[model samples]
Target: MGLRSLQGRSGLVTGAGRGIGREIALGLAAEGMNLALLGRHSATLTETLHACVRHGVKCVALAADVAHPGQVKAAVDSVRRDLGGIDLLVNNAGQVDRAEVPLWEADQAQWWQVVETNLRGPFNLLHSVLPGMVERGSGRVVNLNSGFALRPDGRYTAYATSKAALLRLSDNLAETLRPHGVTILDISPGAVATEMTANMPMFADMVHWGSIPYLVATVVDAARGRLDPLHGRFLHLGRDDLEALLRDAELIRERDARTLRLRPYGDEDPLAAYS
Candidate 1:
């Protein structure tokens, strides 16, 4: 789709100071959407704005730690005031505990920091944005989840657990907001080369099998509303397995609904428990 289509649209991108968030912000700006960029590092956010200004879209860089509810609300409010109402919200801020710590041995501060950033950050942003979006009767919410959300490995308790919770939040929020013409999507961009993963011991190996550009393209499509089925579900970028993703989401929804539907029956009909 042509970028001009989004000329008047407004978007807020968290973590726009670097990496995947920066890329998403640039992509949206390229589509002519005015941007509200959020990050803790002022210099990095400013760099992101400069990089995106070429798209001829208005860009405002705001420094705020998204994990803090107060800061999140203040920053989002400012964005709404400065850039007009937000038509789309990209929840991309996240953190991971040091790579070497075992789950049981993880420091309390490190663990909480990861949870606050990866989980609480989005919750705070969503809490702030959804009310306005709901009142407006239309909006798009994109969550930057991780592959770990689905297939968690050991030694990643903080990151994995928070991401898993985020997926649940996304699924519930999608259903809750869909009636208002709001869509919530959780995007797992596979592996990417970013500051988050740069210092990792397995960085090179992860990148060898990761698909960065594919993930970015998928986000672009999502912003343009071209990605179907995956709109209310999780996406594994660069794989192009939309059919599989859709199928899995459907299966999950069906399973959940079935469980709920059967719960009442279980108490009334002993035979129902067998099924």
Candidate 2:
């Protein structure tokens, strides 16, 4: 498929109040896409809203906790009413573990909060908006995933587990929604400099950081349908060569690469079966 223009399209970006989400919202706005920014922080959402408005695109800031179904429903209704339905949905809102602690030692409330915010938050938003997207027969979804999802990190079990589940959710949704012209992708912005990372002591010694522009460009490409061929696959900003991936889309599909799957003990293992 040819690259599609995003001009005049409508999108909803969760956690658009600050950090990577803010950058993504502004980037989409620069492409002339109308936006509905959803976040818990009113002040930061207002800041992002102004930044998006400066790009001359229709934008609205809605203060809502994505984990709450009622709030998500209200926000989705507002976006549909104001922007004429959503063509893009970015599930960027997430929560990290409050501290580096073992699963057994971590505060139960904090642990569950991370899980609910990162996982259920996306579920809430999707539940509210997916019906409209499916009805329209055209839509895009980008779920911000993490490297932790692929690797086991004992210190942040909740975050790792939630992101891992989210990646699987994207893969499953992609298969279900593909025939409807809706593409779902998982994007991992590895080690980007953000308030969330800065607060994590584990990353204090990290010298190399992912480029925000590169991540934003990846999101923009996904939003414009340039990545439809690789839909349901995982893409890493500042690491993966997107052009090469696009060129080898068929091979990746054939190999079933970049997706989560259960590995069998041996080639003859019956438990290793996959479709």
Candidate 3:
């Protein structure tokens, strides 16, 4: 499925210099979505821009850390100035340095840092981009999440908790934006071969079930409204229930009940009961 229908759309992807973010940017470019790519590494960021151009989509590479409020504002403003208002925003920037650290030994400082990046980072981007999107009355927001958000496997406190909050954040944003035609989705990809996972201790433990492109496709699908069933819901990407899950309109509608309440992010335990 070529996403040529997405040709005229424009988007901003965080952490897009390498790994999954890089693949996502390229995938969007292939569909003709112009990109405003953001990352910390200047060299890798430039490489993403070139890759987007190779796919023949307009591209702008912005070097900025997603965790920095000032940098996030500046980068988003620059994207608006350069590529027009973004029609899509991919909150792909995340960190899990302490995933293996025991909760008792977790550094509070490090935990806060990861929380700021994994959760607050997306919140900031969505906050900055949302008003314009709401005023425009249409847009898409894809918040990258992890399966651990729902099924934590110990030693993943910071990562899992942040992502859990992120999933709820996506739901909250979606409900508020829905009446205005802005769709928000939480999509969790299975293990992929990325720098973040490359040499991690648990890397070999999990199945290399898929690739970065699978996650990218979910973003593209959400952008095109093909993923409406998963909007405002936590969608696990690598399940035997993939097809049924995607097609389960009733399941989606049930989720809408929870999404409509406009609950605060991080209160997912209440919603989980409904699930």
What's the TM-score of every candidate structure? 0.87, 0.96, 0.88
- Top TM-score: which candidate number? 2
**Positional deviation of 97 in candidate 2, in angstroms?**
0.7
Off by over 4 Å in 3: 1-3, 205-207, 240-242, 255-275
Identify the superior model by lDDT, candidate 1 or candidate 2.
2
- Candidate 2, residue 183: Cα displacement in angstroms equals 0.4
lDDT of each: 0.80, 0.91, 0.81
lDDT score, candidate 2: 0.91
Q: How far is candidate 2 from the true structure (C-alpha RMSD, Å)?
A: 2.5
Cα lDDT of model 1 by residue, 170-249, tens digit: 86676778678887788888777788887666564663656666766667677666654444677667464765655675
| Backbone steric clashes in candidate 2, count | 0
